[model samples]
Target: MIILGAVLLIAGFFLGITLLTTAGFVVLIIGAVLMLMGRSGRSVGGRRHYY
Candidate 1:
């Protein structure tokens, strides 16, 4: 998710697409939150890992 977000962000920026940039930022934030929760031994969506 993070990687995808980054790619989208870069692509959006280069292509001048506002929607993709916004979506990418949101996705990146969500992925980071999930990863942090997993590392803290928390379950996300009933799974130990979000991946």
Candidate 2:
């Protein structure tokens, strides 16, 4: 998810696509939140731990 978001962000910026850039930013933030939660030892989706 994070990698995908990064790819979209870079591609969007390079291609000058405003929509894609906005979507990428949103996805990136989601990924970051998930990552933070996981690192804090919280369960993701109530199933698996990130570590």
Candidate 3:
């Protein structure tokens, strides 16, 4: 999800799409939250670690 968001952000920057850029940022935040939750040993599937 983060990778996808990053790709969208880069593309948006080059294409000058304000809406896409904003959506990309929103996805980035969501990805970050998911990553943080996964790293905190509270994720649904299993315990995980973040480097």
Q: Pick the candidate with the highest TM-score.
A: 1
Candidate with best lDDT: 1
lDDT of each residue in 1-51, candidate 2, tens digit only: 777789899999999999999888888888888888988888899845542
Q: Write down the TM-score of every candidate.
A: 0.92, 0.85, 0.80
Model 1: clashing residue pairs? none
lDDT of 1 by residue, 1-51 (tens): 888889989999999999999999998998999999998999999999888
Better of 1 and 3 by TM-score: 1
Model 2 Cα shift for residue 27 (angstroms): 0.6
Cα RMSD to the true fold for all candidates: 0.7, 1.7, 2.8
Arrange candidates, best TM-score first: 1, 2, 3
In model 3, which runs have C-alpha deviations exceeding 4 angstroms?
44-51
Give all candidates' CA lDDT scores: 0.92, 0.84, 0.79
In candidate 1 the C-alpha lDDT for residue 10 amounts to 93
Candidate 3 shows a clash count of: 0
